[model samples]
Target: MTPAHHQARTDGPPHAPELRAAARRLGRRRFLTVTGAAAALAFSVNLPAAGTASAAELDAARLTDDPFTLGVASGDPQPGSVLLWTRLAPVPYQADSGLPAKRIDVSWELALDERFRRVVRRGRATAHPEFHHTVHVEVDHLAPGHVYHYRFRAGRYVSPTGRTRTAPAPHSRASELTFGVVSCQRYDQGHYTAYRHLAQEDVDVVLHLGDYLYEYAVNSSAGSRAYPEGTLPDLFDRETVTLEDYRLRYALYKSDPDLRAAHAAHPFVVTWDDHETENNYAGQTPENSVPPEEFLIRRAAAYRAYWENMPLRRPQLPDGADLRLYRRLHWGRLAQFDVLDTRQYRSNQAYGDGWQFPGPESEDPGRTMTGDAQERWLINGWHRSDALWNVVPQQVTFSQRFNSTSTPSKVSMDSWDGYPASRERMLAGAQAAGVENLMVLTGDVHVHYGFDIKRDFDDPGSRTLGTEIVTTSVTSGRDGSAKPANWETLMAANPHLRFYSGLRGYTTVSLGRELARADFKTVSHVTTEGAPLTTAASFVTEVGEQGLKPA
Candidate 1:
């Protein structure tokens, strides 16, 4: 498919040719206020002669009462900019999104106030059909540590207003910061009640550790929602395997009002785990032993759909079948967030992917959860970081979890326990870096856990180098029980495990100079809507400490 070029449309604001010409010659600092309108006008003046459709022509054919079904989102906030996103879908969940096979201009606005009285920036961007009509505008040159409101417009329709904030200046000092941790919200299992509550939290950013959507086939037993209406249609009963399938699945998930509300409320940093493509996929290899050639095609489709729907910058866009998801974000001098991608570059699971104690083959020094290149990047970042807190947000359990309290203990081959060499090296690196407060935030396992990260898990008195907090699922395993079947065995086998909960919810972390507080929030029910929420447990890790204490 050819790249789209935007043309002036009736739905967009009137052009300013003189201002556009002046903006073209202005410097970066001088163009902040005028760049938005100038760029749109300049983009309009350069439209090609062929293959363009007027806004009226397109609107008369397919416009509906509302086209912003997916709502608004902002992410990847920097000191000077934030990425704003919205998809124009009049009749969502369809192949064409009920629009002609062409591109349309979308107008956008950013303001100092929600009422649009003090408009800061206004612009237009092209929404191409090839990319599912999603608009991602990077609003730049904004003041640091300031909140802004944004929205999109198309053909007389306006999207819901979204709030976003830029990070503080690099050299500035911050005393405290708060963020929400979430993952594994399977649409088929339950309502998005966790997101509904998370939307109202006072947080700086949201770190999504993965499994944003599952690839499982829909069934009659999926939650309590009726089929062909509130739930998935029979046509989508099969697992996703193609580009259209992935796009449609994303549309289905984005249609949830609660989930949409959460995205609108705060900026999010996202990374994906197994279910985003297929369960437990490793390096180009499928979970069920399909040929790599067949799996790469599916991976490419998933990657493209993910980039289209996500509020990521151009640098993180998919190249062929790969994406660079592991990166870093900072909150002034308070915290440094290193978001990781554990699934993309990993070796195949050892011991055929389950709970067991494998031989020395699983302890191979060359094997890594994050491939060699990403490991070097992470280590380098750790060594270079000077922030008070170093936070690692990633998927899967980091600490070793044993099934029994006896010798020759068994562990899940799917987690870091399966790659002990890599886990040990990470702890050693953190120790070598002499970080002030090293904390790891994790997801997957459908349960919450607070534990001490030791340099050596085999020894009971090993050096404590960091702390690990594993958040529970948003709605993965339905309304799970308070105590899982193997709860006693796990707790006895791993004494470092301070807390655990088997339920559907998320984790909220409040980071300060002295201590970091983590609230393990849970929902009473997910099989139904409007579930009541509560803080099941709370833990605090003091600065310079490497373990969790009850708060």
Candidate 2:
């Protein structure tokens, strides 16, 4: 939590990033009062304005009028350029009134061939309205990790032709690479059948380790059931602050055509959790932070309406309640992925009144989850990675999942089981950087683990220290919250748990230069929406032994 204790919030306006410093010492006046209580708790939480305002205000229609509506997507890429995104939705259900801002002209192409004769790179961008009209377009130079095919014409509505790839040139030696990793998605619980089997596989990228959305309360029953349209809204009134409540919650998860055909054929690498900023919020507060100054202004208006409906790449936006969102990506030399931000520079949740939850206080090694400049920018990208897989992707479950029973449980003080010496300096800085295939990729525990990690998974003398998979949930509240006598007393109290499934699904990996496979992929249920993936489980690590075996 430093960057001079960070900044960003600027009235109804900016909404997040003031983080101040009460989290005491490493010192300067406890860093400026933890920075002015994070910027008066991120401009007192008024977070509204993310979408839904054009039922009658637009004016950009000359090139035609197909208005995408949350389709046509792509991400990061680099080598010549690749970002492209779209949102439009003109009047598909009303929100500021779609199709006006220069009537939507948004062409983008790239073929050499997903079958377009052979063209190479093309561009055009504009959806306007300061950004609610969404359309990103990064697309540069071209020719790196190959495989391409894209589409998104507007005025006559086209989209759906997407399959992209490009990353290999930083020294190139690639062999194999496949990817996928998802997280919490709660459109009234169920049916993205793990994004319709990640839009029929052949993966290239889709990490997204976050809650995507679930502020709760449309008949909120939680953890086990309710909201099959019993007229939905209440895990606290599905908690949003507005922009027609974050554009009707991203137009009900972009009207799931299997999460828009896995965001129009692959390429997604997001990061945002605590339901994108609220529950158990720390660096800025709100899950249950005793009115910690209006839950840091309702988490800087729910993280600037989740950086205005993600597909990011505008240098990850949100300047005023501050948002950098840890990043780094590459896949061609067989993987590099980083992406962290453990709930925006954390610190709070080291519990009290008799040691109960959230921790680090046995003596704060500078209370952080990933802040000492993001753990020295992830130990300097694991001492400048060489890649045959590095992949951290992150959100939670960085291996220490406590509750070793002191009884009367509520949950570990707040997970790396509450910072056991910053998870032993990030697993002894990836085992003093000889870092082999160190794969982490997790999602907030909606049950599905795998583990093997050990600086001491409760010491039988500790060593292993590498693999973890986690993943589960397109619907929250882990399917079956343990209890078959606490799953045999947590498998005789954690023997580096190898598997646990409640199942909703997502996780597919491949990496390979020797081995780096994972395939939990379950999902014949989530009550309803799209459901069908099922590989159940598989694991593997090999390539100079980094851990997890079971294949």
Highest lDDT, which number? 1
Residue-level lDDT tens digits of model 1 in 217-303: 766445554445544456467799877788878888898899999999999999999888999988766899664444666776787
Task: Rate residue 386 of model 1 by lDDT.
Answer: 87
Candidate 1: list runs displaced more than 4 Å.
1-62, 219-222, 227-231
Provide the TM-score for each candidate, comma-separated: 0.89, 0.34
Q: Model 1 scores what on Cα lDDT?
A: 0.82
Per-residue alpha-carbon lDDT of model 2 for 239-286, expressed as tens digits? 565445655567556755778888878878788878766565767655
Give the per-residue Cα lDDT of candidate 2 at 290.
44
lDDT of 2 at 119: 72
Question: What are the RMSD figures for all models against the true structure?
Answer: 10.8, 21.3
Backbone clash pairs for candidate 1 read none
